[model samples]
Target: MTKYLISFEKGAMDHIPEADWPEVGKAARAVCDEAKDAGVFVFADGLRYDDGDVQHAVVDVDGVVTDGPYPESKELIGGVLIVDVPMREEALRWAAKTAAACRCAQDVRKFIDGPNNA
Candidate 1:
């Protein structure tokens, strides 16, 4: 099996109306629950970026740490879902569900199979 990460960029849902957030949350959670029931969900969580608790940092090869996420980065990851599936097609299908539920675009990428990835 291969592990895939399905995620969305920060602020991808900024266009969603405030009042609709609750429904969006419900829809997203339902998708997660479905994945869990299917035994493909490895992990899922929304980053607490809006709450001021989430911070970013950057480290270089010299071990110098700087306030995170290079200034050039236009976006940060807002949420993450990891799934273990037999093929990339299944991962893409799951990402589609996530995008619809979250009202945002989703990206899917496979993890390298190794101790670091596992």
Candidate 2:
């Protein structure tokens, strides 16, 4: 099986109508259910707005953890899903399904080959 990084680009959802947001949530849940039924879902979750937490963090040298996000940026991670699929096609299909359900763009790309990958 292959792992993929499926993400929406920053500002990708701007075109969606406000009235459709609830429907997007419903669609996302449905896709999650479909993934589970297919036995390809590893994990999936939505993210909460954490910009305040990030702004408060102050990291120090020596890789020490501090009070806030390391750096401030306009764009931060929104949410994510991780899935194990038999091939890239399957991963792309899942991403397409997610995009349709969320009513936002979802990009699907293979996880790079690296050490310690299962």
Q: What is the lDDT of residue 16 in candidate 1?
A: 99
CA lDDT, every model vs. true structure: 0.89, 0.73
State the RMSD for candidate 1.
Answer: 1.9
Candidate 1 regions exceeding 4 Å error are 116-118
**C-alpha RMSD by candidate, in order:** 1.9, 3.3
Judged by lDDT, which candidate is best? 1
Count the clashes in each prediction: 1, 3
lDDT per residue for candidate 1 within 20-92, as digits (tens), equals 9999999999999999999999999987654565377778799998875448645678999999999999999
Q: What value of lDDT does candidate 2 attain over all alpha carbons? A: 0.73
lDDT for 107 (candidate 1): 89
Q: Give the lDDT of residue 9 in candidate 2.
A: 52
- lDDT by residue (tens digit), candidate 2, 1-118: 7778777754566688999888878888888888889888877776544555444444468777675443556345455677788788889889888888776778777876666347
